[model samples]
Target: MTTNNVRGHRRRLPAIVATVIATALTLTACGGGSDAASDDDAATAGAADDGSFPVTIEHAFGETTLEEVPERVVTLGWSTHDIVAALGVVPVGVPETWGGDDEGYSEWFRDQVEDEIGGALPEILNYDDSGELDFEQVLALAPDVIIAPVWGVDEVSYDRLSEIAPTVAHLDPENSWSSTWQDLTVMVGEVLGRSDAAGELVAQTETLLDDATQAHPEFAGASFVYGLTLSDGATELGLYIPDDPRVRLLRELGFVDTPAMQTVLDSVEGGNWYGGVSLEELDTVEADLFLAWSAGPEELAYTLEHPTFSRWAPIASGHYLFFEDEALAMATNGPSPLSIEWALANGFVDKLADALAGGAVTVS
Candidate 1:
């Protein structure tokens, strides 16, 4: 029974309806039907040609556009460079760190970005003690546009970053990493005049996700607990409430969460949020599949060795699952098109296969 303290870190979204309209426009941008009139039938294929119009977008951040291909684009926040690079637009600069240290970006993303775009790592722009973005350094980079999707930046940060260039923020707080990836890919595509490539990448990723999900039908009809434990031994259990992409993904696998987990899930109020319980109350989390995350190696060790923890029915029944930081992070935070396939290939597929096979292997 652990309280989900991490929910306190929930993203703050704009209350203004303007943000909603912006989101719709961004989706249209992603779908590849810009308002600009193009005479070339080839342009409708999501390509740029001699008749392509000058596209300028105004959003929550600010207004900016591309008369032609932008030379210097700056990507902000965590892991957006992957989408940009996937669309063949190498960012001139990106945040060296996502939050504080923590390797900031995923290994798969870093390798892919570096492989596609050869350049020095971008400057790290985050709070230095008092929680303030280094706007001066960002301004120095002089980027054509800024792509930020991971963290929920405040209005001030949004304004400042927008001043440098158009800054793309998360469309909705509840939306997962995959939504951010799709939105930013289109946003970057618009600026770089690579909408065709953007559409192709999105299509490709959709296909990959479809194939991966179809490969593991055993995951169907199972419910799971997706969450993390902090250094203080507190657990942040993902209730997998309705509308959450993870829950949606699980549903796609032909599985449903156990009634126990679903009970706690229904108890969540205000939003598709969570239920907080004490570590002593771990029994509340009831599911056929248990997936927990540790902040690091030490946390994981403590969880496995704890005498009281072994008494938990799930652990005792061998339904307990624990993931290292990497898998945990990827499962929750890495929601890109590539990420879905990566998650499947890396271990998710095998785990489902084993689960379906009724193997005695413990999920490590």
Candidate 2:
């Protein structure tokens, strides 16, 4: 059994710092306000004067105290931008979204910025394929604070970013991506002086998930295995652990993990979110339903026709769900208040219901 190890594989800070220094040398000194604020220009107008500031938040890289509500904010990592936007604070800089709209923004985020907030998009910071932050770009933004509660910010990166501005790293020092949506929202709210508002938002989103669970009684006690099948002709079947946000969301919807999933979890080391099982042993990981995401239609077609995958119980019995829409898949995999609402409105729950009805479904 081969394992796809993703833990502690991030590029060390010396290499990242060297790259940033090299990139900084070529860049001209431009004003930070060129594309920092939204069209409305009142970035902090929506922030409540709840006396939540002068707050110290403990994170993976020690503690950071915000003296006042952040006016010029910058967000790194997945979902931090979404959470900031959801809380009515327009960020000066945000990480570019992968599998998002053409402009490197999520559809829900774009709608919120353009239609709801009546603001222009923030500057999109570039990151490498390995999810390394562009330190030079972040430094150029001259932000008041850097929010990154769910990113892979190692000690060195955190210290460097702190030199630029007070930076918040992950909640757990050991696990880079362990913070749940609820924990992240509360932390963001505290930073923005909107603790009450954050609590309300959490409750509202949870209510939506609860409503779905109550509405779908069949999901109760059902077994499920969520994973991915590579289009690159890999010999292993990737599986997400229960702690993964996607699997946690499924569990919230009343699904339970299977013994096969437990086996995978038992084999996984700390800090890794996923594992893999050989295709030859696919039948051993049986469950009432199987779920996966495909890169596109061609990838889905390839998996369905693969000799070994074709014989898997879920595929043969038509009890499987596949996502062909990258945006929808991103919404579930990295959920936030804005994305969750957009997902439900755009048939995320319905797709699951259709799959649970005992037929293979490929959501487009």
Best-fitting candidate, scored by TM-score:
2
Per-residue CA lDDT of candidate 1, range 280-344, in tens?
66676665665565566677667656666656665566654555535434544545544454455
Candidate 2 similarity to native, TM-score: 0.85
For residues 174-247, what per-residue lDDT tens digits would candidate 2 score against the true structure? 78786788899889888776665567677778888888889889899989999986676789888999878889
Separately for all candidates shown, the number of backbone clashes (residues 3 or more apart, or on different chains) is 12, 0
lDDT of 2: 0.75
TM-score of each prediction: 0.69, 0.85
Measured with C-alpha atoms, the lDDT of residue 33 in candidate 2 is 15
Looking at model 2, residue 136 earns an lDDT score of 94
Q: Which residue pairs of candidate 2 clash?
A: none
Give me the runs in candidate 2 sitting further than 4 Å from their true place: 1-42, 128-131
